[model samples]
Target: MVSENETIRRHEQDAFDSTHSQEERNEHGQFATPYDLARAMAEDLQSRVPSDSHVLEPSCGTGSFISALSALSDSFTITGVEKDSSLSETAQRLWANDSCNIVNADFFDYASSESEQFDAIISNPPYSRHHHLSQSEKRFYSQLAVSFSGVSLSGLAGLHAYFLLVGTGMLKTGGIGSWLIPSELFSVNYGEPIRKFLTQKVTLERIHFFDPENLQFDDALVTSCVTVIKREKPGDGARAVFTYGDFRSPRKTISIPLRELAALPKWQHLENYEERENHSGRVLGDYFKAKRGIATGGNSFFIKTRDEWHNEGIADEWLSPILPAPRSFHLSEVTSDASGWPQESDIALLNIPRTASYANLPTPVRKYLDGCPEKIRGSYILRHRSPWYSIGNTKSAPIVCTYMSRSDSTPFRFIRNKSDATITNAYLGLYPQTSMSEEELDSMCNMLNNIPSDVLINGGREYGGGLKKLEPRELMSLPLTSSPS
Candidate 1:
């Protein structure tokens, strides 16, 4: 007869194998946590759990938590479950030499059936949304959340929130749990349910926000935070420790009173508290509607310099005065001619005409249009009554910023528009509402120009070839607007 622990491991492995195919795991964002991160999270929980307490790692990818528990001499019982079959098998193999109970079933389903309660729960659950869940699975998890937290999570919420909610149900009264979840929950709209659960359902102990500059996962691009909470009666004066930097060795730590955290509508406000204070005057959202520049399906095929157009006899109407990638433009004050065209600049805007206007095109331009490839002619731009060469209204905004930039260079730098050329969709257009004067705009531009490079580097996201993209949402969230008047 097999030992109890071995039997449990086999049962878990068999269940996993029966349920998940290899392709399904990859689609579900099923990357297992690194050993170091698992160990660190386990150690943090171990420090909080009483001796001999039962600990559950729901959605446990391959028993990293089990391995961590094995190292402890607290007489603790560990119950680990993984939904992915391959990972569950790997977990069983890694812990083959050890003694621990492992389950190879979906934790969401298991939690619904079982009434067993644990002294502690720890997990790095899946990050995918309801789209990954079957219709029935979504309904099950949705009902579970509504029953537990009284708040309905958005369908867009990742699978991890469900794990957190279900895991909360499996915990014995006064049991503490640590979750390795995305830092975005503290800030995103969909994360409100998770936040509400953390604030009201449990006594949140601490939140460790990792430095975005040093991301945790090689495959995942998101920032992460470790949330520790205990099941207890909701009470006032519950304080939460906020630590930033290395979890093993933090650089900055703040103990935020729970009252303050609950009072704020947005938790992202806490990430950069100092910046928030400095820019509390007025938000960019208060005065302007910020939008991304544009997204051409293929920039290489679409954007061309004036020389390239002239040498190839490409129709001027086929090009638009698109701002070169942020690197190419240096100045701030862009000037357009009386016709709103860039004055005497080699940078020509792509300007295709509508079908009605096409008949009026010059001979050279008409010939060029006729010579276009069949593939190009069939594109969405060409299919429209107006072709891709047709430019949108040339209305220039008072201010423009590079939408994408690298961290190593500068943070938020203003472009001095010395050139008579306009930008394409690679820039951010800042259109002022009816709120501020010209003097204020000039002052705002100067203030933005002087923003420290470090702040800019931290705020932007990276791309290949050292490229970085800054969305209006990210830019608007910055604390710069909070600066003292």
Candidate 2:
């Protein structure tokens, strides 16, 4: 029987997290669900699953779901599978008195067993990115996913995709399936299989997106969504509910037809389907060309603070003034002195010449290069460059748009760059492709600074923890309020 003492159980979870290293937890993509959220999800699952239903939890960590289900009803038989031996042992001990069974076995292996099926599958699967898995691991997961869903999983998919597909496959006909997976599945290219399976194979019931500003899990940085589906294949005119904000009381809800899902490049924005196209046709690219700042393979090694450079006796000629990260440089307008250094910040970029022989370079320059560690010098990005240390195209632009910021409050800041100092990849440099006057440039920056938050957020990708990022191409496609050209 599961422990009735909720406080004591929560204390055990805290102890378990303290015992595990951050690196170890990250590699395993192990993050426990908060009890409140688990309870809410369990309540929702209760509505879909039949009485006396058997529930399956894949990648169960510390038995959040088990505890939630036990509180709801004692009749529902629950099975939790965890790959980690220690977590499974703890869960077994915690729920020893309960009717639930905890298994310490690889889920992929267990899921492949043809003999078992469940009335409901519910879990927050691992969010491990594909890059962490070895070639053999990727091949195994991909093959199993394809076998289960008949849709070829992309090599780039995270571990969450496999759980969704395999777990759904293990469901009884007309069984219910639900998952708390990364919102990336709604936006990234690799989510095709899950999206296809939901629309074409299973009936997508509803997808609830948590307000990014208020995350459900404490430490996990992933923006999450709760997706509910049924095992039955879709028929004509099937619709799925998309809700945003708090699950208890959603801020917005929209029902979209299943057939229309395949046409969308991404599904997260369905929460704002009504106002998604309220902007004008004219975009930033119509007047100015946006480009990402240069990549100095190793920013720390290639960029130096003003004090560090001056103390090293490196001549001003060997270094070019560069803007620091947006967080470090606060001014909306950058002005340079006669020496072309931004008066606000002292960071500078080194322009190590590849054409010149290393031996023939100035003593200070040679000393600086000698100080660089082997790892920085041999980094993949640097190794690919003709002269590993030389970062090219260090020219400054008139306008620099803040590349990323918090989604809820911080709108993208378009800084008027009145200086000759270049920017790093942290900011997008906007150059007037066509002729424009000084007044036009000023107006452009002002307009961008005042642009509605939705205009920028809809144009860019929202990363974990409410961070919205705009790449060069994504920024160019956004509608600009004013014409500066």
Best by TM-score: 2
Instruction: Write model 1 residue lDDT over 1-485, tens digit each, in one string.
Output: 32344345446545664577655654586655666777788888888889788888887776756766776553777777877677777776666443467788988777778778899988888877567778777788889877655668887777888777778777888899898887767665677777776777678898887766555665555667788888885688787788887887888877776667776545542555534434455556566666666544345555677788776676555666656676665666566666555553556655654543777867666776576667766776557634555545544566788766554556455653433355567677777767666667777777777766655544554432344455787667444644323
lDDT of 1 at 459: 56
For model 2, the stretches where C-alpha displacement exceeds 4 angstroms are: 1-12, 93-99, 259-261, 269-271, 285-290, 298-301, 304-316, 335-347, 373-386, 431-443, 481-485
lDDT of each: 0.68, 0.83
Model number with the top lDDT: 2
TM-score (C-alpha) between model 1 and the true structure: 0.79
Q: What is the per-residue lDDT of model 2 for residues 1-485, given as tens digits with 9 covering 90 to 100?
A: 43565566678789889998876777788888888888889999999889799999988877888888888899898899999987888888787565688889899988777468899988999888888888898888888888877877878888888889888889999999889988878876688667877889899999998877666777778889999989999889999999988886888899888998867666776666755655566888888788889888888888898789878888777788888898877689988798778888788888766677788888988888888898988888888988676787788999999988884566588899888899888888999888878888888888888887876776677767788877787788777655654
lDDT at residue 63 of model 1 (Cα atoms) = 70
**Global lDDT for candidate 1?**
0.68
